[model samples]
Target: MTGPGQNPNGPGAGLPPVPSIPLTDETARDVAGEQSVGGLVKDVMTQVSTLLRAEIELAKIEVGAEVKKALRGSVFFILALTIVCFSLFFLFFAIAELLADLGLYRSASFGIVWVAMLVTAGLFGFLGYRKVRRLRAPERTIETIKDTAAALRHPGEHS
Candidate 1:
């Protein structure tokens, strides 16, 4: 029966019949014989295995890159921190020297300098502790990889 965008009999009702490309029985058999269900399953399994292997390798590479980046960033941060600490130390020493020159050292100059140095050290130590905690915190990507690997190794284990 005719439908929308279709001829009443079939497609191309008014056109000449298209020439068919005849294939020999042997050719047809050869083409069809290679496409069994088992072969198709094997092909799919191979592809899945290949894709999984590539994904795993890529994950490993990314993890390594992330670790390297974190290390470099930490190194740079530590270096900058060291520079800042030294600068503060020098600044405090200069202040102490200025106080001594102004004859304030005989009064409470040493106490002030000592208190300032201790306070600065304590503040910086706290900040460093916080930074270290942040740096050592568990990464989401690493956690995801762990989860994925566990799932791949033992399917249906996660609840």
Candidate 2:
């Protein structure tokens, strides 16, 4: 059986009685009455400023990381482009020579390869332009900023 002044149905049935905190005027007023509206507003403004600063720092870190990744990728991409550009002359020259061997005039064979290369380049460039045109702004960051603004405007409401 639980002793008097002991909790009977908790995880510990005979737990010792906890000490009470004697409230002072400030604590009593904080617990039982409204704090001054000015104090409350100051506290909220301080917290919101801190939160916005943190958000800005997080965005900067995120953007910095992404920029580093893009820089690394672009370096490799440029290297590949340089190598391909140097190699294409040999490849197209071989094609032109093969065409000349197949009984076409040397000038005509070279001109045909030039025309074909131009058409292929134009096709790829158009496709890349369309793909880039479809790129959109950063949606997640925009959404988060919007949510923060809404929360700041209506502190009591939650999504």
Q: Highest lDDT: which candidate?
A: 2
Q: For residues 1-159, what per-residue lDDT tens digits would candidate 2 score against the true structure?
A: 876766688743533333222334667656787769898898777776766765665556556655655555455445545544754785667665664655666655665666666555555555545544544454544666788999879979978
Give the number of the best model, judged by TM-score: 2
- Each prediction's TM-score versus the true structure: 0.38, 0.47
lDDT of 1 by residue, 43-127 (tens): 7677557655655555555566556556655654565566556656656665656546554553256446555655665666565
Backbone clashes in model 1, listed as residue pairs: none
Lowest lDDT block of 10, candidate 1: 14-23
Off by over 4 Å in 1: 1-32, 102-159
lDDT scores in order = 0.57, 0.60
